[model samples]
Target chain A: MNDGARLAAADRSARVRHADRAARFVADAGQTDWHDAVLWRIRGKRDAAAGRVEGWERLRALASEIKEHTLSRLDEYLAAFEEAATANGAQVHWAADADAHNRIVRDVLRARGVRRVVKSKSMLTEECGLNPYLEARGFEVVDTDLGERIVQLREEPPSHLVAPAIHVRKEEIAALFHEKLGTPADADDPRLLAAAMREDLRARFLAADAAITGVNFAVASTGALVLVTNEGNADLGAHLAPAHIACMGIEKLIPKPEHLGVFLRLLARSATGQPLSVYTSYFCRPPPGRELHIVLVDNGRSRRLAQPDFRAALKCIRCGACLNTCPVYRRSGGHSYGATPSGPIGAILAPGMDMKRYASLPFASSLCGSCSDVCPVKIDIHAQLHRWRQVAAREGYVAWPKRWGMRVAGWIVRSPRRYRLAGRLARAWLRHAPRRLRYGSWNAWGRARELPRVPDRSFGEWYAAERGKK
Target chain B: MKVGLFAPCYIDQFYPQAAVATLELLERLGCDVAYPRGQTCCGQPMANAGCAPAAEAAHRHVAACFEGFDYVVGPSGSCVLHLREHVEGAPDARYYELCQFLVEVLQVERLDAAFACRVGLHASCHGLRGLRLARASERQEPPFDYVAYLLDMVDGVERVPLDRPDECCGFGGMFAIEEEAVSVRMGADRLADHLRQRVEVITGTDMSCLMHLEGLIRRRNLPLRVLHVAEILNGSGEARNG
Candidate 1:
């Protein structure tokens, strides 16, 4: 397929039919409960990790301020970063869109005659559909991160940002390894499965001709690429491969090396509850024989930055803390989001990418505001979700039934007389309606919950009779 | 101080007793409270559904009705939050959720009320997180709960501890029907937590949440009951065994 067709296909697949998909996930009550418990445990661990710090909230605020500062004068920082990176002997490429991004990577690999590539966990690469694009053109792409590889082997998208394959069970992984990598069929132990994955990844890493990694932080002053990983696989891939390419969104820039300390302290704790990742590797310059290429992709981020209502999302450090703490995300699972980065952050970002396609994302939440509280960068995620709903409605993405419902309800609520009449009629219907009709298919609430029993008099009616003279 | 009582549409209709209890509770606390007759709804339903412009008329109506009051207090946190956060050209500053008004506005040091029942306190999301009426579990700040403090002041109110104190009851307006399956599942889990603690009555700052849980309880023929915090604090809960 052409790039446009491919992108259209990806967009189609990513359009979240949230309610329908969430219903499917919640249908299996046992699985939903298990998912909720696992994520809640992660949230608990994050709380403990964050609580141990003397000024964790302060660190989060500082990080948010630094990001806001960097984004405000992004043009100047981008120039500085390009100059510094070039001085450090690394080539930097700018891609205005995803098509340009995918093509740039393809051209780089083609020029180097790279046959096989190993990629660490990069949500940006997933966002650009890089793996599929490269594979279709006959270059073998293997995900090196253990969780990423599990999903790659299963031919599915990574479910969570940090854990990637968090939704999958160990028994399922053991079965997958047995089918694909010759592991013992009964090897459901986590350690054994991890060992098998490590062994399999080792061979692929050694044989790979190129490496692609996602940048955690790009320092403008130092011209460095920072990668935070738990498995140490990204370091291996970037060092062992003959050519290394780092893909990052424009929002990834941090002003100086000193500012990195604040984010580094918060990233792992909020992500996996570790004080720091096992591999916090920084690449300043390419190794002697290998070449380093940095692809700065815009891909709609610049547009988001231009909007004040959404620019706070740019402060995100890609921590999955919001997802772990989100009750909806926990019960619905990541796949229900049908976006690359599925959760509160994704809900805000996806709509800007394609309003018509991802309209359901913004409305998926209950506006519970927990995501905002746990956010390491203090992104007002729930507020953004609320804002995006307005955008969706204005853009004609909201369904007609809801739109008309709101319109009629709005008219009724604006006038006390109309509202009173509507209330009286509703109460009368509730009190006198037939059982089958009252609890029918049209009433979603009545499927599992009974509607409120109507009362004899409204509070307004009671007040007029008893307290009007007083 | 003269207060304007803003009972949400649902509370005004199906759960009028909670509104009555709120009025009585406020009066007993030595405040002059008036029910604004022209008040119907707070425009929250439209605003939260993403039609903010459509809610303008309702917001103006609210401002007009409660214009002269010293404070506009509502029994539902969800509705009050919408007024504070979403309403335009409305009296946002004067709008207060019932617990917030009692704790922060009235400074009620004591209550001459009691209900001998094991009650599960459902921390409605808007009250706990939006209004900052309590310390949300997600934050590592100084712990406080206005609703619980008021509950503690009443005699014989056994506040049963929940495994998950502040998780949402999934009664997000329109969310209840829009994402019915997940909504029901979330509400079910919340009820399960209360049932696990052997809670005889589930009470909260908002009747919307209780209405959702109560719907489930009635459907299943559960022994538990739901009461707004106002009813329990007004000394009416002890008389209602059903």
Candidate 2:
């Protein structure tokens, strides 16, 4: 996602959205312990179904190591995939950023003499603002997956990467289906809602000039793109359309299908409690005479590949597993992120584009580690967040007042004599601390906490005086 | 053995009783305990909150204070963890959480102290994940070590199961106040989980996290009391259980 765009949007929301409402909007969301409660329920079910699998952690390590190893040789893999893709009668193109990426996708569709496109869920496309770009280019695009279809009719982009409609209540979905897809107007049943969506998308699947799909994983061994979905829209989109375009980020490559097993195990279990997704489709050949195009979009991922502390972020499979278990994400609804791919993953990914602009995004996380706990490949989310904060500070993204305050903090803590003097003074200050601070930015501290009244003397002073008296 | 007491700044002033309890616990556990006069706060608040460069001078000062002690112990897990795990390129790194020092270094099988109550376990993010005191890994089967194991050893202790069990209580030093809405919500969520399990007293290694929860618990009028895990391991006195 564009940090400039997200920050601009977040800033605009800040004007109209009060801090109390913003906080309440997030708090009154789904539930308090929802992420934790839901994740455990999902995990407990998976553990039981999968039986006792040994080497779970090693598998994650190997997956992370393999991705790390692959990122180091990413250029070689990209070149290899390009060669193999071209040999297989598919075309490959590289786009440096979101605008460049959108242009490439639009050009491909325009050159094909196509004005209508169908799509499967792809966060890469969302990051590049592809749908709007294509629509602006005068092409009509329809989303095929059920969740995407619900969000598409609302004329809003997805709130989630995977489960795009997670924020909408079921009743809201029932009403949406009633108005958009012409389900029985009086009906509130999800089955009826699904049936209505199925009928509406079926015709678009057949008639669209080309189909766009996001790649979950692209295997280097077979030079194929992997799309894991429950709806099988990727298969329909890739198969039925005369032409298929797959938009994928650069970090999606692994050595072989054999390596797919380790990731496959962790992905579904972490994502939605399933042992494996309903469909794991691998497309290597143009399906029975249809043309295939795979656009390898960077949009800042190449820069992400070079950073030691952050390169691991490229390993994301878009499983939404991290979001599913993030306590912070559970509270703050995705719209608060004001960009695609909102959640713990989005908070970190937003800054990769511009450290100065999206500095607040990293601070959004509580460093709870739930995202890390549920992550399939073990992204040390909070650690990466801590790393980004340091990066942002070093790069001059931190404001001066905070920086000066931290400097004062560092100075006092670093010296026993100075700290002691400060402590003595602070004690006196605390004894007289008013309901509101007469100075400084932290009136919030006084608003909630009752400042402990200072004792008559410092503990050290008491210890020394008592010893002398004795 | 010479055990250096590293009293974190906040605990030294606001909660000296915690330091006193720790010192007495150490002496009772049979160590030649000494509070290093020049000791100061570990620079974690600066480091984790994105000012490691500013934290450098403090890091050096901490290294100097406990440089020669065989075991440096602190009442707060989060602070002691900063010494063992956070400080980078510092000359002095040997340190332990009071429980870890007691269980790992001293190997005290019995305490002259005791406590009786239904206590919930609050795992501080630093002590739990950073210090590897809790079983935290994605590669192997995870384990809960020092805190859980220590709590299990205490007399009359009933460890309540929290929903996420390991969810952070969200007293993230400066974060609790900086991002009060989300931070307090997270702490409140953690507290409610412990409450659901009907725990009357909650205990953890990090006092600041407990302080945050204690504030909320007190404000909300919940009967739950917050305890530092060290205070509990020192065990309850006659009539203090109430």
Candidate 3:
């Protein structure tokens, strides 16, 4: 194979080993602690915000029920949305996969003779590699969200959904701006850094011939696309350009416009603990004479939807609450997942898209169920992670050592006699074993955690002695 | 009531005192308890590791051991939960974590127990979320802690406050070995919360979690110790015998 192919293969292999990547991420103890604190603070803020609402659990149940209802009749809803959108003078296109989605977007841009395009924060685009695809086809695409723009400048995929560059320190951003955007040397002020980004993106927004944004919720009844953002970049990008293209996964549909009240309420508070995002823009039709297009992408979502056990993952609203609440995501960072969506949600979703390449993603969590409790849509995320582990094991993706070790343990544990014998031998060894031997490389449990002290007698023996005395 | 004591394998071998305390505590509560000899493990270690086929035999073994009991009680919430959820076609035996049985079944409103120390209550994840022994910190519900309620009944036992209560101590069965780095880091963070509260003792519903935290405390040589709630409750009370 060629150099590029070899490099890509190596990258894929590296991503498959999540434990190794997480270990490397945590090696910088200070940064891991800071990341943990940042995400945890967000989780705390979310809890405080959620507490103010009287019927928060009821709202979650309602949201979950609505999504379940929509998914059950997704085909009917999609057709209704397409008809409503077409009547509203917006073009509707369907893409079966990432390649089809990218091709459709490219085709639309080419037909309009659009040379430059500006995009707001859209994880779907990242998943589809839209910018790189367009760039290879000779279109200059710029990400307008400040976080996305920073990661764009650094040539890295987003490390977070809500805060794309959260992994990058302010000092690093300042250094990056100093080297690339010619900002003042050692300028670390947030206001100054944001101003620098604003100036750079403003020029691109004006020159761009078309705008692309992600749809947070697509109303089936009215065919209106809703975009929620704190920065209002989605509005600027979509309104400034003559042509607007909104890309969304088919699962982003709500049955009616009124359902927005419940989703919008849960979305912002769960995402960043805000009462509401600054911009909750609705687009039913384009500005007079400006073209509007909606590309509905499937790209493995339909396959995942068909899975009875994992279908609930499709109910996610891209709020990133699960990411904020996940302990594994907080310490390891999103980049470790090597996917667009990271955290507990990513662990469950990524395997459906590519099982072999993403097998290790499921086992990355501690199964604490925090993600499920914090989820706005009430997806059983940790339970899904456990389900995926079962899938991975059944499909022969588990390492042989673990498989065999569990088998041996199972055999011993099934019989009381063997279990007692094993316990006696293990206790004796633990009691008399040399410190060096007990703490050796083979003792993975002892590498970080100390071995528990073994008692001289088992509970069974002690119980027998107590009964004899009685 | 006839009670079967279901001691988890870890507690049976390494921390037998916890099981003994559980047995004595139940006896003090006027229940005839039996330590079924045919019992082994709850098969959680294998089940959680995605080896359910391997775990099936142990599940069957455990179900058979506790079949005839009126109520099966164990000190570990996680193990009890594992049995309830994973033991397929097992007899419909009534099982309870010790706190659940004491509070819900026995309806023990008061205890003649005492412990004169500020102890931090580590709400083990399984006991808190799995068994609903307490309202989780993430929810918007009214606060309630069964473990704290029981501990409150014990004289001279002062419960200390933690910054973030109900966080997992990260002894996730096989997860401790599979993801050792993250497991240890999470445990250390939980330890920091307890240490920050200046508590001399940390007690919880699950000894598995306490075992992990105690391991860390012992390794660091900190002036703190861990105990199962049963050990504390049983250590107190000179009550009349049944």
Candidate 4:
């Protein structure tokens, strides 16, 4: 589906759009609890891993500084990277948007006469709609990562960045495999499922004519691309195929090779609590007779870079720490976001892509600031969410009811006399109105929870009666 | 020092006792506390809902009401945070959440108060993460909670441990209604942690959070009570229970 259609499918109503999708996910309370517990366990593991390192906060500060510096000089760094990569026997392609990005990839494949392709996990490709774009043109693209393959078979967008298909249970995966991949009917064992996926992907890897992977960090000084993964799928895909295409957001650039250590140290630990990713592949130049293609896609990143308040978000290393630590994200499944790179980071990033469609994304959180706290590069995530809310409101994306309600409430709260009168009126309504009327269909707060019991006297009234005596 | 008492809109209407507890507690702590009669609400509700322009007047009102106090103290971290961060007129005003005022400003060493109960502390998001009243679990910083420290000083008060210490109670003002399902689920999960700890009363610096949890507890008819930390610190002999 197109971004507009996908966003529309996820949304039902202005008041309860995101909440409706989340409600469906949490309808199975047992499953919701299990999901919450599992993510919380991951958060706990991250905490333990981070606590083991001395000066972790300082390291985060340094990483933030490095990203900020690179972003400030992004054009200079991009030109340098282009120049260096070209000298290193790599062809660099620039895409102004998603359509441009997809067209560039297709042209590269067409030029090379490539048919079948093996791909690793790349949120950039997912954002650009490359898989469907390639498959539509008879390119026969297959995702080699186990989790990516499961979602690919199900024709679903990944619910997470690091652990795609995290929302899927092992039993469901077994069922999906049984129907799609011809696994045993009773195969629920994790090891067995993984082994089954390995056997299936092994064949595709060998038959592939080209490969596509996402870049973790593009070293501008050295013109090298770095990809980190536990599955080693990127290595298999890029090496086994004659032509390799590495697509990356322009924000992935770091100034020097030395800066890679700071990110490498924090990436896996922040993501999955592994001290380091098992495979950290750096490809500076292709082997003889092998084609290396680097597509640097803008895809709304330049617009994001122009936003002072939100540009810090570009500093994200795609660590799922913000996702794991977010209370709202844990309870509300990532798919409920209905955007690529779901979670706190996505909430901030997606709105910049399409404000009207992804308007509810910013309001998805409680503004708890946990996302900002856990972020390795110190992006003020929750602050950015708040900023986006204001931006949405200014742009008239907020619902009319909320806008009018806030405007009216603002007038009342502005004057103490009007506020006291409103408080008294609210109290009287709560106390004297019939239960049915007070807890009517219009009252969303009263649906699952009781409204607060209205006291006979407000604190203002009590203060006047007792403490205001002269 | 003269302190201006700022009760959040919720506390002013639905939770007056929490404001009362705060007023009494501050006075007892030797603060020359005054509740400015012209005070109403901080612009937090409007601002949090993304209508910062609408909240501008309320921000100006807050600045006018609490203009001259050495510090402006409120019972809620959520409201205090809004005032500190977004009060356009009083950008430099010394607004503080109740706990921060007590722990940082007063340097309060002892409390002549006691609550003979096991209490589960819900670290309200604004107070814990926004106000920095406590160390959030997400941080790699050393463990410290000013609210817990004060609670520890209370005689006969046993603070219970929770599995998720600083998770949000999901009471994000309009979020309680807008995202009702996730909000209720989050509150329910937080309550489960407290119930697991076998605490009689769940307390937090922000009654807004306790208010949300209390709504759920009252609806479910759970065997628990909610109180603001001020009520406990103000001498909990007068505290009401479910």
Those runs of model 2 whose alpha carbons end farther than 4 Å from true positions after fitting are A1-24, A27-51, A434-442, A446-459, A462-470, B90-93, B136-142, B236-240
DockQ category of candidate 4:
high
Please give the range of 10 consecutive residues that has the lowest summed lDDT in model 2 chain A.
A13-22
Off by over 4 Å in 1: A1-15, B89-92
Per-residue lDDT over A342-377 for candidate 3, one digit per residue giving the tens place of the 0 to 100 score: 888988998998888898888898788888998999
- Please give the lDDT score at residue B151 for candidate 4: 91
For model 4, state the Cα shift of residue B1 in Å. Answer: 1.2
lDDT over C-alpha atoms for residue A267 of model 3: 96
lDDT by residue (tens digit), candidate 1, A354-437: 887799998899889999999999999999999999999999988899999999999998888998999999999999999999
- Cα lDDT tens digits, model 2, A1-470, are 24544554455344222123337655663643453455445545544433345766566677788888888899988888888778777888888888988888888898889888999999888888788678766898898888888777766667666678766767888888877777777787888788778888898888899999998888775688888999998888888889999999888888778888888887786677687889999888886678898899888888877787887888887777677656566666666565568777877787787555467667766676667765667777777888888987888877788888899999887777898898888887877756346234555544444444456665565555653343
Q: For model 4 chain A, give the 10-residue run with minimal summed lDDT.
A: A8-17
Candidate 4, residue A111: Cα displacement in angstroms equals: 1.3
Model 2 earns a TM-score of: 0.92
Residue A208 of model 2, lDDT score: 90
For candidate 4, the lDDT comes to 0.90
Poorly placed runs, candidate 3 (over 4 Å): A1-10, A13-15, A468-470, B90-93, B236-242
Q: Is candidate 1 or candidate 2 better by TM-score?
A: 1
Colliding residue pairs in candidate 4? none
- Which one is best on DockQ? 4
User: What is the C-alpha lDDT profile of model 1 across B84-196, one tens digit per residue?
Assistant: 87566665669999989999988989998989889999999998889999999878787899999999987888999999999988889899999999888889899999999
Candidate 4 C-alpha lDDT tens digits along A112-151:
8999999999999999889888877888899998899998
What does DockQ come to for candidate 4? 0.86
